[model samples]
Target: MSKFIPLSVPNLKGNELKYVTKAVETEWVSTGGPYVNDFEKNVAEYVKAKGAVSCQNGTSGLHIALLLCGVTRDDEVIVPTLTFIAAVNPVRYIGAEPIFMDCDDSLTMDADKLDEFCREECILIDGKLISHKTNKHIKVVLVVHVFGNMADMERIMQIAKQYNLIVVEDATEAIGTYYTKGKYNGKFAGTIGTIGVFSFNGNKIITTGGGGMIVSEDKELLKKAKHLTTQAKSDELYYTHDEIGYNYRMTNLQAALGLAQLEQLEGFIKTKEENYNLYRNKIQEIKGLTILDFRADIRSNHWFYALHCDENYPLSRDEIIRYLALKGIQSRPIWGLINDQEPYIGSQVYKIEKAKYFWERVVNIPCSTNLTKKDALYVIECLKNAV
Candidate 1:
């Protein structure tokens, strides 16, 4: 009970040490190594994508995705304001602006609002959707699968197709998530869009210390992504750079760790699902508090469980977070709306109502794969007596 219950942390009880030790013994610790290639292939195969490109991190993978999607300075991308800032930062990284959208109940981008924006806020030119406010070409829709809850991709994809917008899935928190029933049956989170991205951060469901992967059905884009992440060397022998590129390739050591993590990903997801249900059932018995549910149609990773503090709750969202901290339970509020952040203060936003609603009431509770039933019971007891 004295040990802090982290909100989310890596479950590395797999072959992490062995694989990393092998990589170190072989002296292929840097970016260029067999582990990197194997990791990419294994991830793509797991997610059922045609291919995947490993990168330094999710943000870098997104930067490469935006470029591959042809988002330029003259373009605008539709994004959710409710997600982590990293999901929207890549738009700015490419010099393209983001048109912030609101969130639905699932905490993902509102497909209804997105469709409304494209249908009413923008005008279609010669095969291009241009924003009426800025007159920039609305080229892509950057959808984040928030907290491993799959976005409304079925509707979002329809909206994208009707408006000719490229769909980029930020599936960083949704690596093992997939639809059980729908048009996307059997399609993984990151594999549903034109390009999908996944993260392996220290605090994610799995960890590679730090790294990401880009998956796509498009072979050419995958090839170019690998090229761009590797510094666009047309000829490595001569060190010729054909285009501007990034030093975003993942290190072999990270991949070695990732391969091990990937091996146990499904097992981690099972543990997450079990722990999530335990927290949900126990927390539901506490008045004025409820654990938010992931969409039933999809098998989610349940990466981070959301504890909603209704007005009748004994403490406000921030207050509950503080109380949990005092109880040695780590909990945090959902991210501040990205549009309101200093870096994106003046950015365009479309009906950011629900995002604010969720932001004010939702607290992310501990749901790490390694969390045991005893730890979950302790967390629930703290919430039950928080009053």
Candidate 2:
């Protein structure tokens, strides 16, 4: 019975109008234009990547990244079962199989389990890690930075190196997040991995209406991604094709919006951090409820705020979400485990321990970047009263 609080939404109160108007006035609204190039360059610089290629959306970016990783019809990619379906669907898009792994307390893929699965469950043959279960070559590790929390990239990278796995970071929720106390202390989330992808969906920390970017330290891979996203034309003038490609480039208008969004991303993250702390402070006093934290070692974007409803709490995760919804406040349970989904029912899931625990008890509260302190307190109050 108050102002509706959304779970997450874009903050578009910056140069969005100016840049988008320029694109419209200049009539560079299609897939090609200066804004597109500018957006790519700016994002590359922001993330400290060698280069970035703009794509239609994060899913398409993942598809192109997997294609460039040489993932074939039967190859396997290690992925977290605790992520949105979009993260794993791209594996299927490439006709590859996904070896689902569980999440740790941070809700990111468990690096220790990942290492165990590679060392004890798989075999190394001719410098390739072959899954003994499926007998498929595990060529890549697609790690999603769940809810803007950075995974244990340090340990995961070590494991990846040991097993010859290409690391692809799905940093759709963690654009500005970076390490503060590790080997990659100064690196951004998307830059540390072999290839990284970002999303600008409506519900993400930032939005280009709907767009994504692919970044990589390898310039040649970035170049190939750019080429492949644009129909894989060897000769642009004659439209000559060298290989199969996708029409996945971002439009100038979308890029215009993205460039503007990138400019305000730091500010957005600031708001998110403050609001998240506010939620944490308020929710801590409520019995049997704890606000899930981002990894303490990294500066997170704080994209979404999750609360764990333990047995001490009287409400179920679904009950809390439904109560909040009835009161005009939006909250949601964590995504259903991807491993349990119909498409991935037959896929391999290893040591799914913490994922099942968090999946049932974690409820994400409203955490939009534009959410005010008062809004956050209101949501917290609603939660406290719901109990």
Candidate 3:
């Protein structure tokens, strides 16, 4: 049997072993260590954020970020329907419901639809935007940068500002992506909103095995996020509890791996971009399928590459995935629309047009940073033959 080309996997060829070994030798494998602080510092500098706080995982970071945003029971957070369930689960963790929104061509949240929803389906009362359907206070817009493709943050931010909504960018899949044009030119994905969270899960651009980081321009909010994630202890020596908190701090071992991954992030991104372009060039002429691109105005990390299969395709999305698996290649369809999920069936969804379209058509292909040119070509050839 031939070697399997995975959909996405960790590329840990950097100093991962050395750092992790050192952490183990120093007996700092737990949540507290110098590597943890160093990892946070390196990530903050890389993403150009004022501060970053390390957490157990992206979901926890999101939970704390939403908490800091003051999301309470009966509050609604606007979220994209075309993302991993983890992006929306944090809203429920805070006792808040999610209002699922659709995606645009780029597979990110549609800022136009968001604006329309706010203007027509909601009303501002005493400086608070209340949803007409459930009468819940709409507090945050949880925008996930799907597959490293950024949403229209400029327009989204404008609508959010006009409606007094806090924007929480769920950048779990977009660590190195940044805009190159417009109001947030040179701004990273997770740093532009009210607060942003990045995941370093095994499948992400960079992996800490399982970890996440929270970033914000506001120092106070960043500090508060740190506090909440660290058990909300008002006094370190006395261990005085100010309020409820969570043990969401990232472990030193995870930070050790993360620090090494951070060092090679730019290089990994370059490789991902090159491979994506290779896939684009090779697959563009294929009938019945199209490889999606990142936003033109941004230098995206080019994380996961989605192949949009139209009706002209010879096989369905699931069929293609199965074929790829038989050929020792891994592929997957996009996430099921969040609104349709069993837990969120009762939640509100606004004119979910494009999200459902993309969900049915989009198939993620092999896009690991270490994927060689030959591997990419093989994937393209196999996919073409399968169709």
Candidate 4:
């Protein structure tokens, strides 16, 4: 009980040290090495992607994906306001603006609102969907799978196709999540979009310290992503530069750790799913509080457990977080709506009602892969007795 229980942390009990040690011994710890290529291949094969490219981090991957989608300075992307700020920052990285959208009960982008915006607020001219208000081309729909929960891809895809918009899936928190039924049955979260990005941050299901991968079904686009991430070396021997590029390639050391983490990903997901169910059953018995559930149609990674506190709850969301902190348990409130943040003020926003509702009530509890059952029980106990 004295030990501090964290919200999420890496479980590096596998071959991480072994692979990383090997990389160091071989002096292939920088951007170029065998481990980098192996890690990319393993991830692409796991996600059923045509090809994968390694990048410095998820934000960089998203920036590259936006470029590949042809989103320019004259364009705007539709994004969810409820997600982490990293998901929306890439829109501005390319000089494009973001049109924030609301979230549904599942805490993902509301596909219905997206369709409404495109239909009633935009004009399609020669296959280009242009916003009537800003006169900017709406070229991309960037959807984030928040907390490993899959977004409503089926309806979103239909809307994207109708409006000639590119779909980019930010699967940073959903490395192993996939659909089990409907159109995308048997398909992974990142594979369903034109371009998908995955993160290997320390707190993700798996960790490479800090790294990311870009996946796509388009072979040419995948090749271009690799080129753009690697400084666009048309001639590597001569260091010839053709266009603007980023030094966003992942290091061999990070990839080595990533390869090891990827090997144990399925086992980590199993533990996460089991812990999620445990929290769900126990939280239901607590008055005025309950654990949020993932979609019934998909197999989710359950990366973080959301504890929803209602008006009837004994304590407010922030109150519960403070109480848990005093109890030596780490709990955090869900991110503030990105549209309301300082950088995004005055940016276009669709119906943003539901996002604020969830933001004021949701608390992320301890659901790390390394979290013990005793720790989870202790967390729930603290929540139940909070006054």
* lDDT against the true structure, each candidate: 0.92, 0.92, 0.92, 0.94
User: Between candidates 1 and 2, which one is better according to lDDT?
Assistant: 1
Q: What are the per-residue Cα lDDT tens digits for candidate 4 across 1-387?
A: 577998998999999999999999999989999999999999999999998999999999999999999998999999999999999998998899999999998899999999999999999998999999999999999999999999999999999999999999999999999999999999998999899999999999999999999999999999999999999999999999999989999999999999999999999999999899988898898778889989999999999888898988888988888888899988899999999999999999998999999999999999889888888888878787874
Candidate 1, residue 187: CA error in Å?
0.4
What's each prediction's TM-score? 0.99, 0.98, 0.98, 0.99
**Which is the leading candidate under lDDT?**
4
For lDDT, candidate 3 versus 4, the one ahead is: 4
lDDT of 4: 0.94
- Write candidate 1's Cα lDDT for 118-158 as tens digits: 88999999999988888899999999999989998899999
lDDT of 3 by residue, 1-387 (tens): 768988889998999999999999999999899999999999999989999999999999999999999999878899999899999898888788899898899999998899999999999999999999888899999999999989899999999999999999999999999999999999999998989999999999999999999999999998899889999999989999899989999999999999999999999999999998898988888898889988999999999999988988898888988888998998999999989999999788999999888888889999998899999999899878875
lDDT of 2: 0.92
Q: Deviation in angstroms for 160 in model 1?
A: 0.5
- Cα RMSD (angstroms) for every candidate in the order listed: 0.9, 0.9, 1.0, 0.8
**Residue 312 of model 1, lDDT score:** 78
User: What is the overall TM-score of model 1 with all chains considered together?
Assistant: 0.99
What pairs collide in candidate 3?
none
